[model samples]
Target chain A: MSETKKLMYVNRKAPYGTIYAWESLEVVLIGAAFEQDVSVAFVDDGVYQLCKDQDTTGLGIKNFSATYKALGDYDVNKLYIEKESLEARGLTLDDLMPLVYEDEDDDWAEKDSIKVVSSQEMAELFEQSDVLFNF
Target chain B: MKLSIQVNEGPYNHEASVSALNYTKAALEAGHEIFRVFFYHDGVNNGTRYTTPPQDDINIANSWSELADKHGLDLVVCVAAAQRRGIVDEGEQERNGKDGNNIAPGFRISGLGQLIEAGIQSERLVVFGD
Candidate 1:
């Protein structure tokens, strides 16, 4: 059997006003479909992607944020958020979707689970990954 | 390990530039050398010297330039992409009958060979696109 590939998806843009967020999600879903070990990290304005109260109906745009919730169904459950980003945006864990892991989780609590991390930790994740995709 | 990065989206148009920067930084930090960073499509706009983002916004072009300057990085902007986007050096500007040159320092206008060479030589090649 082929070894599972370690893939990391880095998102650094806002959820709306651009296609990067949606396209990045598409890549992640496809990667998951291949059974690749995938993890997604939201940084900078990308944190907006997990905000709970998004409303895109008024703009006549499809609500791509919902697609994020479906990522888990594809086995893309390793979602990461930069702690500093959330704090900078004045967003707490409660303000985000319930699927995300909180920052207070123990360092090695979940061996293969999604977890919020600091920028320094994110750098390490990038180094450890066999394949890294920036979107 | 050799690595090739293709930047196909312009700075500020999305997070392509930021992600490219972070990826490059991480690769270098992990002791992996970048074989080449090829800027194509709208990515050539990153080499434009006239870009000046607001103070509140991230100046992605400057970030890229600074990274290249610090690492002695090979920053290649596609010639065709630059010409189409009106980003050219002094010689190209003159040749194209353009009045001014907006190509930034530390960025080279080159052909697709750079990208092809990177793909052939690198163990892993990642592309950053819109």
Candidate 2:
């Protein structure tokens, strides 16, 4: 078996407007299938991707937010959200989907856990990963 | 590590620019050099200096300029994409009979060589699309 490498996936697009967001999620899933240690970070408008309620039917787009909930099943649970992004959007921790972790939470106490982080901290996540994918 | 970063969305149109910036910062922080950052399709809009987002909104063009200023990062915009979008540098402006160059301060209009170079230079090349 090939040695597993750590990878970080950064999602920065909203869910419905473009294919970037969904494509990024697909990449994460592919990485996980390879047994790579995959982590995903949602920043900027990408935070909208994890909103508790997403209805893409009206937009004629498939709803992929549910796929995010399945990340855990693939062990791709190192999901992150930017603290400032949430606030700028007038969204709070509770407004997001349950899979996300805020920067303040203890759940991400471990170095390997998926957690929310500041912009500065996000830089660190990139530094640590063997591969960094931005989508 | 060979780093090939593909930026697909336009500047300020979404968070892809910020993510690209953050990814660049992280790559540099990790002591790794960036191979190349390729701006394609709508991503070519990122190379324009003429953009002015609302004061309250984040300035992606400025963010990209800062990255180039601080790190000397190579920002490459696909010429075909740029031309189609009406984004050209001074030389192109003269050749195409355009009024002026709209490219951002730090960006350079180049061909796919830069993209190929990025793929060969970085250990991992990631694509950020919109």
Off by over 4 Å in 1: A100-114, B1-7, B10-122, B128-130
Q: What is the lDDT, from 0 to 100, of the residue A111 in candidate 2?
A: 32
lDDT of 1 by residue, A4-46 (tens): 6677788988888876687567556655655667788999998
**B35-88 per-residue lDDT for model 2 (tens digits):** 678886678898888777899977887788888888888889977668878999
Chain B TM-score of every predicted model: 0.94, 0.91
DockQ for the candidates, in order? 0.09, 0.13
Worst 10 residues of 2 chain B by lDDT: B112-121
Q: Model 2: clashing residue pairs?
A: A78-A114, B1-B122, B1-B123, B2-B121, B2-B122, B2-B123, B3-B122
- What lDDT does candidate 2 reach at residue A64? 81
lDDT of 2 by residue, A32-82 (tens): 656667678889999999888888778886788888877766766678789
lDDT of all predictions: 0.77, 0.76
Best by lDDT: 1
